[model samples]
Target: MKKEILGGLRFFLLMTVLCGGVYTLAVTGVAQLVFPHQANGSLMKEDSKVIGSSLIGQNFTDESYFHGRPSEVSQLSPYASEYKEMITERTQAIQEENGSTSAVPADLVMGSASGIDPHISVAGANYQAKRIADSRNVEIQRINDIIEANKEKDLLTGNEYINVLVVNAALNRLE
Candidate 1:
């Protein structure tokens, strides 16, 4: 009985040290070395100031800037009635701007599964191109160029996406 109890305790300690300490350190060390930028949250900076992370979506509703998908958190407002009215008005404005009688793109009004997806479908970005172009005082062609330049394509997954935060930051840096 004594030997069995001692062996069990030894096994528990071994796992505790290996899984809890060594495994964690090894994984962290490898991540820090290999993916330092992403491991550090893929932060984007402007003028040496950290603006936002490319991996996270942000709320942008300015007439000049391209707006992201409707945030799920925004739906949790206490004033549900007012929120619905505001959203309806906002959607109407977008529809008018897009010159489309059909509904806006799903990604535009539908919050992503993560609720903070940084990338939006190319179509989603293009939907706001006109407004953003006019607001920035930059030609529409130049804005298109910026969008194409910053587009992300995954060869394996065949998924194309544009990181809104990164695109917006690049837009800010445009001469």
Candidate 2:
């Protein structure tokens, strides 16, 4: 019984150190070397100030900026229909601000599963292109060009996606 107890204790300690310490360090080291930007939360900067990250979303309610989907961190929970209504009303208000006849894209009114997805669908970006252009006093064609330039194609399906934060950053640079 003594020998069995000792053996079990040794195995548990060995596995804990090996799995919790060595393996974690090894994987983290490899990730740091291979994908330093992504491994470090894909943070984005402006004027050397860390404005946000490429992996998370934030509210963009101003008329001049292209908005991401409504964040779940609102007074009404994301699952509630009232929350969706709020998103719809906001999008429509922006559309009205720009006098855009085009309908609002679905993604703009719906939050991503993570509630803070940086990427918006291609359709979502284009839907706001006119509004952004009008508010910025830039040509619509130029806005479309910026959208196309920022699109990221899916590896498996080849569908286009846009990173909202990056695109907004690029737009800020246009000024």
Candidate 3:
């Protein structure tokens, strides 16, 4: 009985080390090496200061900068009410005005799970072009051209998405 219990303890310890420590380290190391860019790309450096992450979107309200898709994520309202109430009220208003069913596009309704999605629908990007152009004192044609240039081809079918971070980076490079 004593021998059996000792053997069982040893087996459990060996399995824990193999499955938890060794496996986790091996997989993580390999993943980091295989996707180095993705692992490091989240860090954004600006003027020697880490400004933000490319993985998340910042709230850019200035007309000079392009706007991202509408965010459905809401904070605590000044009024004391349930969080769901706020969302329901806003969603109901939108549905009544737009006549959209509950099947609204993912981008149009709920915020990204990460709350920092850097990609926007092509339509959302285009919608902000005019405002951006006007704010930058640039020609609308020029802005339209930029949007067209950055437009992504349909990957599988008709779904096209623009990486906002990439486009904004390119825009900064423009003279």
Candidate 4:
């Protein structure tokens, strides 16, 4: 009986070390080495020292800067005591105005889970082109040409997408 109990304890200890220690180190170490860009704390340093992931969306409302996709994340007015109630009231009002029972698109209605998405839909990007061009005193046609140039072509169907971060970076290059 004593020998059996000791054997069982040793087996449990061996399994724990092998599964917990070795497996975790191998997986995490390999992942960090293989994908250095996604390694801890690398993404935050890629953009301006704003301390946000460029992969996420941010709210940009100024007419001079291009706006990102609409954010669904809402904060209660400081005057309101209950933030959830405030959100409910505002959503109800929007629903009544739209006269639709369908929920808004997840991307359109609610902010991306990361709250820092930098991309916008083609339509959303186009909508802001006029405002950005007007603010910069650049020709709208030139802005349109830039947009067209940045579009990513699809391999099979030749579909194109304009990455917002890349476009904004290009805008910064414009004199």
Off by over 4 Å in 4: 1-16, 40-51, 73-117, 153-159
TM-score, prediction 1: 0.77
Residues 38-154, candidate 4: write the lDDT tens digits: 666335433455444556655655556665654554564546767546555555643443344444322334444455666655544565577688888999887787778786765
Better of 1 and 3 by TM-score: 1
Best by lDDT: 2
After superposing candidate 2, which stretches have Cα over 4 Å from the reference?
A: 73-91
For residue 162, model 2's alpha carbon misses the true position, in angstroms, by 1.0
Indicate the worst ten consecutive residues by lDDT in candidate 4: 104-113
Which stretches in model 3 have alpha-carbon errors above 4 Å? 41-51, 73-115
- The whole-model lDDT of each prediction reads 0.80, 0.84, 0.66, 0.62
Question: Candidate 1: where is the Cα deviation over 4 Å?
Answer: 1-6, 73-90, 96-103, 154-159
Candidate 3, 10-113: lDDT as tens digits: 99999999999999989878879998757676666655777567677776655566655555555655365665576566567545534444433445344665
For model 1, where is the 10-residue window of minimal lDDT?
70-79
Q: Is 2 or 3 the stronger prediction by lDDT?
A: 2
The numbered model that scores best in TM-score is 2
lDDT of 1 by residue, 1-175 (tens): 9999999999999999999999999998999999999989989999999999888888877767767876574544646787667667767877887666666766776566677777787778888888788888889888788789989897999877788888888788786
Clashes of 4: 6
Score every model by TM-score.
0.77, 0.80, 0.64, 0.56
TM-score ranking from best candidate downward? 2, 1, 3, 4
Number of colliding residue pairs in each model: 0, 0, 0, 6
